[model samples]
Target: MKESEKHISHFDIVVIGGGASGMMAAGTAAARGKRVCIVEKNNELGKKLKITGGGRCNITNATYDIHALLSMYGKAHKFLYTPFSLFGVNDTFRFFEERGLPLVVEAGNRAFPHTHNAHDVFRVLEKYCIDNGVVVMLDAPVERMVMCRTKARIDAIETSKGSITARAYIFATGGASHPETGSTGDAFHWLKDMGHTVTPPSPNIVPLRTAESWVHTLSGVSVDSMKITFLVDGVKKFHKTGKILFTHFGLSGPLILNSAHTIADMLHEGVVTASVDVVPHLAHGDLDKHIQEIFSEHKNKNFKNVAEYIAPHGMAVSLMMMPGMPLSDTKVHSITKEERKHIVHTLKDMRCTITGLMGMDKAVVSDGGVPLGDIDLKTMRSRLVDNLYITGDLLHINRPSGGYSLQLCWTTGWIAGSCAE
Candidate 1:
């Protein structure tokens, strides 16, 4: 038969969305003697996965304790106990290592393939699927479903090419983010139509925008150690300390992306702002003393030079331009005590008002999906649809950007594959 004329029918299991979780699930099921097939809308698998962490693919964290790993999932931590315990971080290491793809743990306990190529990670999984006898159909977008008489279960799925039937179906279609990678949230609408309560999808772990011109001036400046406080109407809501990268629009990096949620929420009521402490480890008094010493050491030098030594040159320049700030050209020896205090304040409390969040195209991971109650956390099977399993970003588990998202994909995909009859 011609490739387009091929109609795969009556498989033991059928998996949708050939991304990380979908590929993992299909490969896992086929490994255990199940006749499995993966239906991917895109021509290639793992498009988004290939680009994660800029193509390095942080597979999981070195945090081996199940509790610690689960904690990264936040409120959904409890829901993941079963899947994670089944195939947690260590097991992930073993899974990849056994496949001859070793992982290395970098700073922050993030584990990436030793090759540091995300395509390498996907290559292994793709080979696993191919070697295990799993059928892969690319460009087969699921159009709609064929539900059973009860209207409470999915009997089969009708795709763009043809209809597929299976004893079990795994929907690992990911989420709405990165639609360019083919995760356009087809399952969300499909699941919601089937009575599942899907939480509204929003861009998560995305960069923030700012109205402050100073932020734009410091566009490529990055502070290795800094604290960011999210405030609404000048009242602090929350804060975190980490590295931050100033962008033309606003902020990016671990410090800003993780806090974007609080900023998103605070946008409703007041002016959302971010107050950055470039030297969070240093106290006000200590910083002043330190600045005083630096000024004395470079008494005749331009303040700009000293400021650049204290912080990034761009930030120093921007700080000097802030309202009522002394000129960057001022000599350090001529700096007044009040001017010293102003410098300290600017160093400790660089402020920017958030304008908005970047759109879904830039989201590292989306914040919403099918709520947990709709599926059994123990098995990743639908409570409403008995023969159906869901995994990955399809679940409404919000987590910070790290290896946590991919780990969730690994665990849930493996479990869904293992448990699917």
Candidate 2:
């Protein structure tokens, strides 16, 4: 053995990458009276979890129906049934709420801790590990897995700290997204070397950049109820309704993030664009009548003075100031009938060209990991390597934002921890 490899430490289970799944798996194993150690590259764990949902931490989507929740994962739904059936969303709620971190459901059935502090969620997992006697090795970046080729199992792993030998190993190193949080694609390469088919990852759930500077000025503004339609060369492709948030670069929020993948595909075909209807529920006649009432209410007022009443909250300035929009100096009563119709049209069809999606750096979740065919999702164990298991973003599953990603971590981690023999 080499000098570093000679310093071997033994454990009943060794979990790599102390983000969401690794921490869960280590704590679960330790609770079962196994000697467990969690290795993390970062000085602290849960860097990504800490900032998820803007630090409020959307713990899981409260979709109680197993079939309904699984559908969100796209193609991997079939592979996931076994794991989730064993440790499903209800189990997730029981696990945390019993431990004193109660979760509350909000719009879209998205769940968060009542405190809404992500750090508290991390603390719950951390406390689980500490109470169960799991050893944590922070800042110990793993170099490579030492595989027993003939036995088809991981014999040990080389890390900056030293070599670690475990009866079973769980890899939860996450996929490439938010690299600043330490979820780099190091494990994907290692799995490829082991002959696993690692899919090349791309930013899946991310924000879109737009061509309009007017959109940029509305940064930090969000429309609670709106509809956005995507098109290619002026032909409608698809549309979704919910909420949309404007960023300095473009558009975001749950609605936009979920649409990014499809929009990305559309971008490849031709020039992609979008039309935002600020008041989707209002028909043309209804909206026009509403605007007429607002105009009559302030008959002598300048257009800009009453723009806020017609436009979405906090967006009147930017929308009214658009190049072709009615001049702010124009009196509301003097506004031409054609201009009145134009205003209604603009509200219904707020046009903007989609430039592109933000890269991996801004991605909430990236798809690409070992295909489900190579995983026994029943136990999250590798089909080829008997004693090796995979969890979290390491498994190729395409899911939208909101709480699906973290729920995957919890479900897979629990099953792997329970079944790792």
For this target, which candidate reaches the highest lDDT against the unseen true structure?
2
Give the alpha carbon lDDT tens digit for every residue of 1-421 in model 1: 4634645588999999999999999999999999999999999999999999888998888898888878888788878888787888888999999999999999989899999999999999999999999999999999888899965667888888888889999998999888899999899888988889989899998999989888888899887888888888988888888888888888899878887776788999898888888888889999999888888889999877787766654577787777767677888888899988987888888888888999999898888998887888778899988889999999999788779899989999999988999
RMSD of each: 2.5, 1.8
Q: Candidate 2's residue-wise lDDT over 1-421, tens digit each?
A: 5776456689999999999998999999999999999999999999998998999999999999999999998998888888889998999999999999999999889999999999999999999999999999989999988889688888899898788999999999999999999999889988988889998989989999998987998999998999999999999999999989999999998899999989988999999999999889899999999999999999999999999999999989887866567799889999988899988998999999999999999999887889999988878889988888999998899899879999999998998888888
- Please provide TM-scores, in order, for all candidate models, with all chains considered together: 0.93, 0.95
Using TM-score as the measure, the top candidate is: 2
Model 2, CA-based lDDT: 0.91
| Candidate 1, poorest ten consecutive residues by summed lDDT | 1-10
Off by over 4 Å in 1: 1-8, 300-302, 331-333
Clashes of each: 0, 0
